[model samples]
Target: MPTTPRIADERHRYILEMLQEHGSCKVAELARTLAVSEMTIHRDLAHLARQNLLRKVHGGAVLRNYIELTFQDRAVQNHEAKVAVAQRAQSLVRPGTSLYLSPGSTTHEFALALIQDDLQIYTNSLPTATALARSAPQGLRVTLLGGELVVFVEALVGPATEAALADLRLTHAFIAVTGVSLEGGLTLYTEEEARVIRAVIRAARKTVLLTDASKFGQLVGPQVGHLEDVHVIVSDHIPDAYRQRCEQHDVEILLTADLDVMPTSAPGAAAADRRN
Candidate 1:
């Protein structure tokens, strides 16, 4: 039978979703999943690449941004940078404090880097919750949000998740984003996840954003909130433009290189040495 437009559209949709979730897909794997030939998968990848929806590589295709890799891929992509950010972010975590952690690879690192025994932690990420449950010290408490599971991100989201966070107030909310820019603020691939992040931000007295240099100055997807919404940002590097923007927003930017100094008592009130 000839390849119908409807079947082609469905295949294209599946390909895009796979790229968005898994970061990339091989021609043979896609063909097998769709019950089509390698030739058909090749055509689909080519079409999507031409549309700027994806980038065709040797025998596979990746998301348009090229760097929007899968969670597992991203975790290893900036391993050192993530560790640095996680280390610096952990400095802000005081003993006996309650905090919420948003889903993402870096936040997962933050979950692991955490050593505070006297703390309460809540998360929507299955991987992070499991890590905390398995390795957390006796004084630490881990709460996993209840809702629809998003396997791609390994997080629970949707209205039920949001409702679970409604009545609680935490000392801090540590979050990760797909991109961050002066104009677009914090962004993620889906509004569903963004909605849950917004809830996390609201439930916390303070918000800390965990991201590496790659996320700087880019706009990825739906807006989670502006830079002003966050109390602090922990990253491997902060671009000059973001420095000025953060100063204007009264948002503190903590660099991994300068983990020697502790966070200031007041947000954005860093010592002269740490000011942008």
Candidate 2:
């Protein structure tokens, strides 16, 4: 028999794989097959769902197809670089201030860094909300927008989410994108997500984009906003040519490598250190 912790871990891993292969599965059946309690299976499902790994449905969980990469697949891609970008983005937040967070792995890491501050955060990303809820600093206030839950990306979009955002104002907005083109502007995978991000840009006093070097010069989808709308571009690296292009639009670019020393010794410290 597997130890309790090992069993729990295996069950979670199995559930993720099962969802990937079968699309979805029933809770009761999974529990029976694994020889675990239904309650344990439910808890595991909730944890995976919070990570945006899968979506909980009527009787079980379903694979979120909108994700461009599998959760496990993303765990290894430029992870060190993304963490650095996230750290750089984290320094921008002051304690006791409110901010808006968008969906994406980089932004998700940014959300993790903010968990230790007293902040009022508004976001449509289920993963961001869950991270904040579970690990946020004392006195943190998080508001999740009500809308149609997009299982694939674990983000809230559509008319209802957009409507909810229209009523709120923010001190800063940290947005992540699939690509940032010098000529094409900020692009995303989904138009609906792009629309919500644009709304966030309009609602916030300062807008910062958190992206790694690899995202530069690539065009993914429709434009969400332009360099002109952003107060600063926080990235791990901004090539001289791209820096010049951003400057042309009156956007200030902050490179992670140029920042002062950081307190945390995390792998991405160089990028996170540049925020302030």
Which prediction has the highest lDDT against the true structure?
1
- In model 1, residue pairs whose N, Cα or C atoms come closer than 3 Å (at least 3 residues apart or on different chains), thus clashing, are none
Quote the lDDT for 221 in model 2: 48
Candidate 2 structure, TM-score to reference: 0.67
After superposition, candidate 2 runs with Cα above 4 Å error: 1-67, 70-75, 260-276
Q: How does residue 250 of candidate 1 score in lDDT? A: 64
Which candidate leads the pack in TM-score? 1
Query: Model 1 residue 86 lDDT?
Result: 91
Candidate 1 is scored at a TM of 0.72
**Model 1, stretches more than 4 Å misplaced?**
1-68, 260-276
lDDT, candidate 1, at 193: 83
Worst 10 residues of 2 by lDDT: 262-271
Query: What is the TM-score of each predicted model, taking all chains together?
Result: 0.72, 0.67
For model 2, state the Cα shift of residue 219 in Å.
0.9
